[model samples]
Target: MDKYPYTPGHRGIETSIAAAIDINPKLGRLQRVSEAAIRDAGTQGLTADELAAKLGQDRCSIQPRTSELKRLGIIIDSGLRRSNWTGKSAIVWIIAPMLNSGESPSQ
Candidate 1:
């Protein structure tokens, strides 16, 4: 990832992240990590920056995966937003509706 300073509520930042993930599908690990965190986060949901903090990663690292996971139908917006590192409100993500069981269906 290029070293770009994150500007709160900037459209460019999001666009760049999307572009990177689109180009590199090897970011699968991040997707799994993000999904697990979002599920573990439970109904309260967590913003990208909050998930990053919980995982001890950079916001850029967590944000892109969340975007990808949302696209993959693994997660969804909780219809909530909260302050991020820049003190700007950001959407919180929860696990997708189908994954609510906590345990896999086979378990």
Candidate 2:
């Protein structure tokens, strides 16, 4: 079993969370900003690139924040995908509804 509460083979979330804990204050702020951006986006959902653009930051910089938010159960994958800046499909994310907020990873 994986020791962390993250998907097997996925290091980005784990790494981001770890780095946020010790390396950067900006990342933690970005997570909060990203959360609001995603929530304000409504059902349309924003991809990492879109959020980055809106936040006046680099896409790569904000992508990890999204991953961390997802891991924390604060946001969720919306079962939809949209074209990113590179024209490749990217998963759309939305804030987890209030009812789902209390649910744990196992639920």
Candidate 3:
């Protein structure tokens, strides 16, 4: 996958993208690692920060992978938010409903 630097450059976006591109070969592995972590969290789900801590990775490394998974529809927002260390709220993510727990039954 190819990546371009984030526009409206401020401080380190260029270097960040460059590093990401340099690790392009590992993108799949990163995504899988992230996906598994989120899936394993089950119904409780996880925010990016929680995933990072669980995986022992930095937020920059884990957040982008989760964003990619979300964009690809592998996961969805669980309609919940949790506070981060700084007390700012972040979205909780879960496996896309159709992909988890089979179908609901009223029969």
- Most accurate candidate by lDDT: 3
Ranking 1 against 2 by lDDT, winner: 2
Worst 10 residues of 3 by lDDT: 1-10
Tens-digit lDDT string for candidate 3 (13-83): 88865876666776787788988989899989999999999999888777877777877677889999999
Give the Cα RMSD of candidate 2: 5.4
Better of 1 and 3 by TM-score: 3
Q: In candidate 1, what residue range of length 10 has the lowest lDDT sum?
A: 1-10
Candidate 3 stretches with Cα past 4 Å from truth are: 1-13, 101-107
The most accurate candidate by TM-score is 3
Rank the models by lDDT, top first: 3, 2, 1
lDDT of 2 by residue, 40-90 (tens): 998898999889999999886788777777877888899999999889999
Taken over the whole model, the C-alpha lDDT of each candidate is 0.73, 0.75, 0.77
What TM-score goes with each of the models?
0.70, 0.71, 0.78
